[model samples]
Target: MNSLFLISSAIIIFAIAYVTYGAWLSKQWGVDPSRETPAHTMNDGVDYVPASAPVLLGHHFASIAGAGPIVGPIVAAIFGWIPVMLWIIIGGIFFGGVQDYGSLFASIRHDGKSIGQIIEVNIGKTGKRLFAIFAWLTLLLVVAAFVNIVANTFVSVPQAATASTLFILLAVFFGFAVYRRGVPLAIGSIIGVALLFACIWAGMKFPLVLSKNTWIILLLGYIFVASVTPVWILLQPRDYLNSYLLYAMIAGAVLGLLMYRPEIQLAAFSGFNVGGKYMFPMLFVTVACGAISGFHSLVGSGTSSKQIDKESDAKLIGYGGMLVECVLAVIALITAAYIGGDKLKELLSNGGPINVFSDGVGTFMTRIGIPLEVGKPFTALAISAFALTSLDTATRLARFIFQEFFEDKTKEKQSILVTNRYLSTAITVGLGGLLAVVGWQKVWPLFGSANQLLAALALLALGAWLANVGRNYKMIILPMIFMFIVTLTALVQLIIANIKTNNFILVLFGVLLFVLALVLIKQSYKVLSGSERKGMKA
Candidate 1:
């Protein structure tokens, strides 16, 4: 009956209500879920639609619910649990959920294109191109950050790296068997993952491969193939298969939280102290995806929309899936909180946030009759594999967004097909390869700022979309403004710190942020005060 546990549970419950109510309101305003959904009305069974709601949810959760939810929360817990927990609970439902659901609803109504496409229809022409380019740039950063995350696991933890390699190999085999061959996918995925867990067990007998640089190349190859292949074979199937690993992670965390009942270990506040430096920038950077992730919007509208079998499922997929990710963040916070004090610091210095999550998962596994050493590698591999999911998905989503940015000429002449899979693959591989050079050490600091800025953009887009639909729109505006201020402030602080430290790349990113902020502010001003929105409401 620790107060923290009670508080965490309460946060999750409130988030569900907030998102569900918003979705219901959207139904009232514009969307009629029953009246000929694009999923059912235009069900093509291949890309148009296929997965059941539960399965699709699993897929969405798997893809969006990656290292961000796990690692970010763990690191943010360094500021003590309150700040991290507060951000996740409140931000997920109100901020992240709105971004996801609004983007999905907007995409569906606009004929299942994408957020970038919706921006053109809803925002002005310039807004569309800016959104497209911004989306692509965001994806590049996502790939870079996630590549670093996976690479870190490889460099610092040998057993886990081996497991991650096996997971990728297994995903490939599983992809070919089920996706290419068209076997019973769900059952095949189950078997493949089962075998993978067993292989992970066997991997402890082999030598460890602990070269972060080597893994950077290895992961690049994985992403290249993963991006180029058909969604049925690689993206969908890989995500579908890997979701069970997520399930295992959840199950273990729940069991440990109950059995060990680890006390909430972090203080209510830690004076914003990070690395003995100012805490504001570090906290923001560390908590990127947990509190608010722009990446979720990409998942919401990209592949998830096409695969959604029913419009009613939007609440479940967009809202529910995001809330589930929030809970994962809470679990991460709990783990770090339980570890508490100096031990948390020791673990963080000795390894990284991945080690903290691994330690938590390994503890649970040990309780369930596995050795610590064995559980450690198993946890590591699972996480590394999770990182790959993020990399591939982000690359693909970014590519689609990039191509959409340059598609005006093609669309005007009716020559550009939206489903240009070949071009998209090129974008995916090119961006992924370009990012693989950056291992985690170089990229971790900016993850939060980028993620939050994206969240702010999504909110503005949603606010505009809501106003277009004729709702009060204030609900959307409040969150949008809040995220804009907090995140911009955080980014500014990070920039200042980078300048003092003589970090040129961070300075460049700071410039990028200012540009993005300028564009968004202008767009938002037009949405709020400009007469252009009067006649062009969607």
Candidate 2:
């Protein structure tokens, strides 16, 4: 098994899927170009700013991709490359892509509301409330896990810390110049990307060193600001600019693999049970964002839908963005495979998957005449940048879910806690920060199960909405069913494991999520069965 061969095959498969299956979905879902998107009709200059396809793709991809595709694949490669590769390709195209695209389309059609609100429209107010609580809690797990990831990355790779900080300040300037001052997009992008590279270079020259705890606190503060501020100011431009780093990193890795053609040293199959973990649900849960994630639904519906300039962009930004992540996941998997199982375990025990990924890509870049010192840090910085992207994006999404839960549909006004973005963001960030201090390793498994479960519920919502609107929702049905089984099984295992370990907090969360998912599933079943369509608006 050669790395180049595997990646090439995956790329071809993804391209074909995007053209044939992705196009079929668009046509089936009735993507009308003439219809005005929410971004235009509900333009608020903050959350509802319309963006061109490319810029929106950058933001959507950056937010959803984050370290998910990287972290999930590398960690799940414990089951060997074959299973991970298969899931990334199959799940990305059919499962993740469909959910992401459907969620975006559903939200846009419903006036750019979050998935919770979508549930309210197609299901009922009760279903929406339950889903909102589940979604918000899941977002907290996301924020905690990613914040821990970023903080640890900064402490281990201080140069990335410097680059990430510089990236934020530069994004603010880029957002102001391109969005507010009316600078041309092309010229501004050129300058921004060039400056981005300069920041990386400067980071290597002068690194920023900080304690892990201190970095965590600073990161919490940063996300609080990021969640409350206008999207254009930090989220959009930072993600847009940060996307180029990922693009370059992927391009570099692929080009190096093409040149080097490294052999897949890891075994094809590592048994169903390795180290007391069964492959049944653990493998699926572990390869989450790489295959399919519920988190992507939140991002697509929560933020990307609001910024979409048109409905047609949903396919490219949603479906296409997911495939792009599949490509990255393939790359991450190769990094682990090329190192062999033994070295991978050693690296995992030492610095975790991100370091393994950076080192592998750094070695690859050497084939293209780039120094390992530079290439490794560049890769590290890119991953850290995206992790930070996920951190703040999760915070914002969490804030959205929190605020939406309190919104009174029958009333004309809302409370300050709900209306005040600052207060809401602070509360969300504060809670997530508490979880972050618990460490990512403790939280990742629960997060993975919760994330995949969230995907299941999102699919349920999409299926219900599609059925309500009289469209053929056959595409969403199988994926929805499969995810429920996988995530439910994983959650049960997690609960048992946590109880044995006396980790009551995680056990409590696991039980809560399992119950919420079951309740949502029951409600969606009613809607799908035509027994609960009394107030359905779709």
Local distance difference test scores for all models: 0.70, 0.89
Highest-lDDT candidate: 2
Against the hidden true structure, what lDDT does model 2 obtain? 0.89
| Candidate 1 TM-score, true structure as reference | 0.87
| RMSD each, Å | 3.5, 1.6
Displacement of the residue 36 alpha carbon in candidate 1, Å: 4.7
Model 1 Cα lDDT, one tens digit per residue, 1-538: 2534643584558565655776665655465656555666566644456566766776788888787887788866656677777777777777777777777766676666677676676676687777777677768777777777777766776666666666666766876786468777568866887887766765566646657777777777677666656565566666766777777877776665566566665787777666675556466556666756788877777778877766777777887777777777777777677778788888788777777878876876676777777666666676676777888788767756766765764455532434665666666666655765634345546666767777777777766766665655666777777777777887787788789999978788777876877786787677665455644455
What TM-score does candidate 2 get on C-alpha atoms? 0.97
Error of 2 at 286 (Å): 0.2
lDDT score for residue 216 of model 1: 73
Residue-level lDDT for 93 in candidate 1: 71
lDDT of 2 by residue, 1-538 (tens): 8888998999999999999999999998889878899999999887899998888999999998887788788878778789999999889988999999999999999999999999998878998999999888778878888887888888988998999999999999999999999999999999999999999989889989999999999999899888888888889999999999999999999998889899999988898998888989888898888989999999999999999987888999999999999999999999999988678888888888887899899999999999998898889889889989988889999999999999997888897867899999889998889878865466666877888888999999999998888787999989999999998998898899889999997898888888888888888898788776544444
Please report, as a residue range, the 10-residue window in candidate 1 with the lowest summed lDDT: 409-418
